[model samples]
Target: MSKNPDTATQSSSGVPPLNPADQKRRDAASTLGNASQSKSSPEGVKEGGELPKGWEWKTIPDLVTDDGVFIDGDWVESKDQDPNGDVRLIQLADVGDGVYRNRSDRFMTKAKAHALHCTLLKDGDVLIARMPDPLGRACIFPGDKRLSVTVVDVAIVRSGNGEFDHRWLACFVNAHPFRSAISGLQAGSTRKRISRGNLATIPLPVPPLPEQRRIVAEIEKQFTRLEAGVAALQRVQANLKRYRAAVLKAACEGRLVPTEAELPRRSGVPPLGSAKKRQDAASTFETGEALLARILTERRQNWLARRSHGEGGKARGQYKEPAAPDTTNLPTIPNGWTWANGEQLFSWSSGAGLTQQDIQEGNYPVYGGNGVTGYHNAFVAEIPTLIIGRVGALCGNVYLTDGPAWITDNAIYAIQTPSCVAMRFIRLAFTRAELNKRAAGSGQPFVNQRMLNETVIPLPPLAEQTRIVAEVERRLSVVEELESVVSANLQRATRLRNSILQKAFTGGLR
Candidate 1:
């Protein structure tokens, strides 16, 4: 604040200046001021007798006069404004403590401001906003050139006496309890708001003029120390996030371990390119239709041979739909590699389709294509295998588990077929696949079992598949850990911020 020429008089008792006192004396005085607040009657003894002896509780209206010209107007919400509208203006964003921010915010016309009879801002004036969240946030009007803006629903407070400084009032307005009370004032179902009427009724504590100055100085000192701590933690948070992203990116790129090196590369991409491929060089089963035909024919032959006395117990032709081509119908694979549908690779089953009656306890674990959903006594699949989420939670979010599961039919299961495909590789490939990419749906993205079974899988050598799986886990583990740590630190930062506010409000800053 600029030095006011008005402070010319001295104490009638000829009290000496505060040159001889140490900081401990000032702190002691503040402590006394704080302690006296809890008592009905306080002692008159001052710090060595020159400082003020008593403090008083007051409302905001008691300290600041509603003295400035009352100003209000409908905001002209437009990008274009007259550059010549010269009466200085102060808008909401300009309410930074002890000064106005220099950002180019909204502008208003001087004529409009005059028409509204809004309060004219001046140097050393205290401005408290009547908004939400930071509604009670107060700042001092700077003693400089006028701003080309209009005061919104902000309270401009002018000191009632020359003895009390408005800057000190602004600091108190920004204090903890003040903010907490403001938080309580907000009202709305979604968007919060604080009424201007309630803003004027908030409590205020005032001490003698010089004593107020001492309190402000002490508060600023304490805050500076606290901010240093917060800043240190902030750096730690940033470093953790960076470390996490780096680890995931590196792992996905096959750089986790040195021994598990790159697989031998070919010049051109594999020729089996229709976004799909089928089973390899076997005469047993070629096309899916051919295999189904053969299965049907064999069943018919066995059915005819078994039926001797015209009355057969069970139909020999009856059979499940060839288990949807576990391995035979899949396309030809490269050497040492075999092609297989995701379903046949494991003993698979969907979650129980309980009619709400099967949802009782003592049932089996209900599993969806994604994972466990509920419990039912009856089970379709029983194994810890891969669950490719078919429906909701689109684009293949896979979860691994060995438990009783209740799943939705929206997801599919992968059970054991043979030692052809590395299960881990399948899991990682499913993870790496942007299955959700270009995936469209009104609700959460999803896929069908057919879509999943039909998706192409590049079969590298089984050993290479194992290496890839190992590398992915090694890489993702670090990322997952880092993410967890960063998330925790962020929460901790929030708690620390709240703690500082709580302490500041409960008279800790002194």
Candidate 2:
């Protein structure tokens, strides 16, 4: 919401009063030179840069018409808003760098607009966001199909057919150099902002009227091409996401590599037509059920060992077996593949909590529900361990530690995974399952050891698990490399944008 400006400046004729600091910065620029040129730097006029022959340095107030308005928007509180009213309430979100975002949908009645004295917006008026995230990003206001007024945090500039171009001013404000200068003037410890008073003081680069049009056009032409390239790169990223999903689906489905059952047939084993032939082939390979049994046995022994050492907290009187998955309506798996509940594959436990003070510069990485929340001196889980996000929005997210790590209370880790299983295979399986969708609560969703213990997933033979992990890694590695290239080019595009702006203002556009 915004606060109304003084009644005297409500119409275009009056200029808003400047604060002492604003007045000082404003006076400093003019006192430095009049009609004198300096070399232009990426940081703009503040850096003492030279301008072209016809160009001159001017403050925001010097560029606008005597009748033009430069003021902050009215402070309309949420309580004053009416959703069905006729006047639209523009917000900081609606101001984009050199573009109109039109992201807010707030409105108030025409009567309310008059009562609050909110400045009504026009088509070509420039709106500047005063808050940081690169403060002082300005954009032309494209009218809401209805009447509109912006929030107090946004400064409105109405040139009212002045000697200068509003579009040029918006472009100048968005330039890298201008934003860099504005950043230093921003205040507020919690959320940085540039006051309307301070905003009025920044020195602006003004070119001859005709040159301004040419510079704006050339910048847009290059930007249009850059945007198209970025769009293409984004499409490739989207397709790669689809491709990654396909690879995971195929790997889990026994299609990515030869099945353990089929591999034997390829290696001179008898074809499986008769039951006797199938039995002979099956006996040669270890089945998923057999592998799971070995894992469960190892987990039981570890628990017993911990209990004997008085380490396993709140030990039960008796040892309980891992639960079997309910596979009633599940899809059929290839021969040698079996379904196992989560607990049958690995032992799950909550991680120890580590405070921010305890997390320090160390060799061990500290992990929370999200990966690598910080670094710590001690590790709670060894390298190659499977971790699952246990709480909040990230609950059910899975990650595999590359090195010894400290798992925080916000996540759970596999306390014991049999050496026979491939951790990579488990990570891929959990990812494909989209475990977050099964998380429990609407707010602060969580997955306890009990919840994970009961979740069912398909399991392949130990040998097949190794093959799947290797193949998936190979394909994903290629995707990762291409992603790196795309990422680099995206960064390159940003540099090019800034380069164009720097040239446009410094007379390098020609």
Candidate 3:
């Protein structure tokens, strides 16, 4: 995007513009050097956000004492052939400090270099790309010896000095207003570009001598801290995401629970046990009946709660908890176990419906098909509950609640019988379970209370259920740690990357 202007002469070939007030300060600063400051102090802060009295404010051009401007070089295209040349080539990769540092994987020959004489590199020279998204990004030449490469889509700004600091000037070019103005001038199709001539037009806020060094230091220090924090947050987010996935994986694997109890040592599947064993276990288990009774009682209460408090929804169906013993559905039961539907373990209720007036910006999390969408004043389920999305994008998505919630009409609540099942266990099961898939519908899937209540799930003993939940949590912790370590490393790498940029930008290194 460099303007193809031939500037082998030492004239200000374009604008004849210069601010007189700035010219006066430049003249004044040249005479005083850096002696104007507070007594018995290293330096003083700018007065009322002002630079020290004698400190001059100048554009980039005035700082350089070179006879000719940066445009005093030829502009040419790069080589088309790969070379076995002895000099390292500098590309956009090397033009980072607004100068070339020779980062190309290959070098160019003296013949190739002379053929493509875009711009020549000199000590204290600045190079800025005038193309793509990195337009206006300038780098300073910390000249030693490096290979010269094809200068494709790049502009070089040079100075011969005992004059300006390369590090200080690079930072100034990268600072706010200058970079912004350059980017704003970019115009093209498919690829964006700003002419090198346009880059020369970029305005800069050049504070004199000691002040430039101070501002660069301050900006570097603040940016270093910010880069560190951004790195840490990214690491934490990665760790948390991995941890959550681990938790789910362990829950499904069933390793989280303690497997302290030994199973019966059997050779092959044992022949059918005596019927009397089943009868005895059934008769002795009061829990089987009591848990079921409580669920039915709660289901009735939930129905009443819905009728009283819920916004009048569709009169779909009113389903009671399933009757306790259905021997037809089960041929056998485990010791002290019973076969039952989900209806006997929870109270099902549809979420509330409210017009815009009834809704208020409030504290309660409102559950809908899209998860929590608003703070609601009124509520749906009053206990620890499981909510399933009943419509729209997140249909079949399930969420577990810790307490009372205000939910939208597109979800249904399943409040577990207080003593029967652990709420967390049920929520985990729902996450893995296929509930909506069983519901029959075409356009929008619907799990009416009847279908939901009657859904059958394997009912392990209550004590076993608690054990399973504990095991899931225990196993999840290890997976969580693994994820945390990966995340932390990612964060560290990010911080190091930014540190490289900061060091290079702030004169910490070449």
Candidate 4:
């Protein structure tokens, strides 16, 4: 216990013993000295290097003030923090495209925050994420009332002098070329991260003080207008969705077109002489009920012929009559409309399995739950078929194909449709139904053929169905046109934003 302190630290290799704490302090001082020298000396800028007149090139660390701090965030676990804790914890998710997102739900106790010695963020401080959705995206911190600390991997930057503008620096950090440089310096195989040393070494284009202010002012001015346009675009997109849903709702209610009952009844009597002429006159305005009866007769005849030929012998003993849909609580329809189960109008079957190896590039489209997944040389379903998603998040989505296509097992395909029913009308009915509400699983939502077949649909007369389809298409076409314009303008706005940033850094923005 009373041994000499020097002997306690002696090395077996005879090397001189060093104090660990003293060595750490010396290393820190050396680093700061190198940064200070690099900041003050123009020699750091290579001879004949590219720089605008009156502008200079410097490492990021050089431009920072000697007292300015560069530090990562706290490493506290989520379980240790309280929901209503006194200190807010800034996370990588709380940073967005050049703006601070105040949507964080994490918080820490004030005592715990102080114990960790976390950096207290200030207004106008710059924060950048070391990791990426996009790496190196920077935003200025908007100071808040509550005590705040950021998570590890988020770098906090503070300006040391009046020579640099924080806003301009953030914008430059998000610029394309600067991002490319960051990408090159990134480490790690899967989750890429930029080390603090590498971040400090990044080159920054130092504009004159007055120019930096002007650039920031101009960027904000342009961004205000661009954001207004984006807001308007979003409103239009939301309106389009509502309009589509409204159209489908109206079509299903038989209010989208003139019903047979709305049409003028035949005033003049049919010719008294010919029975054939009278029969033709009576058949002119066939109601949905009359049409259903005819369709059922045709289906029975077809079934009888198939049975005689043994065409579907495998299904002979497995057949079970589908129960009619309960319509006691259903809404009233027009004179020529009726509520009927989907199975009464169409036959549903699951799609056969087709692997990726079975896909062959050709004109025939192969459809999965979300829509066309690939192409194949052969098709399984005929033209004018309806496909419904049967599994996963996309379950209950519906599609109609006008040409032959392959339907993959992730969806259910309509193999038969009664002539009296318009497939387009059926598609609209399904959309209004919102079948996803009936999905059966917690992890992977799914719908079976029985569920869809049992769902009730309001059927309109043949003539009225045709008119409804035409009107819906005409209205949706206009919506589609407006959507295209809005989409194009949004894209243009993005390009313009990038162009402004490019010009600001390249001396093109005067």
Best by TM-score: 2
How well is each residue in 1-510 modelled by candidate 4, as lDDT tens digits?
A: 111111234333211233455443233223222322233312222233345676665545555665665666768786768887888888898877698888877888888887877777888888988888688888888988887888878877776663688899899889765666677667789898776655665556677888999989988898898899899999989999899889888888877887665663454432222122213534356667666666666666656666778887534654444566798899988876777787777778888788888798988889888888998998999767889998999899999988899999999988776766778988888878898889899999999988888889887767788899999999999999998998999899888888788677766675
| C-alpha root-mean-square deviation, candidate 3 | 12.8
RMSD of 1: 13.5
TM-score of 3: 0.42
The per-candidate count of clashes, in order, stands at 44, 11, 14, 0
Q: What TM-score does candidate 1 get on C-alpha atoms? A: 0.49
Candidate closest to the true structure, highest lDDT: 2
Sliding window of 10 residues with minimal summed lDDT for model 4: 1-10
Tens-digit lDDT track of model 3 for 420-499 = 56667766666655665765577766776776666654444455557777766776676567767766776675566445
List candidate 1 segments past 4 Å from native. Answer: 1-53, 66-104, 115-127, 139-146, 150-153, 160-171, 258-510
Count clashing pairs, candidate 2. 11
Model 2 regions more than 4 Å off: 1-49, 267-283, 312-314, 355-357, 391-395, 439-451
C-alpha lDDT (0 to 100) for residue 199 of candidate 2: 62
Instruction: Score candidate 3 by lDDT.
Output: 0.55
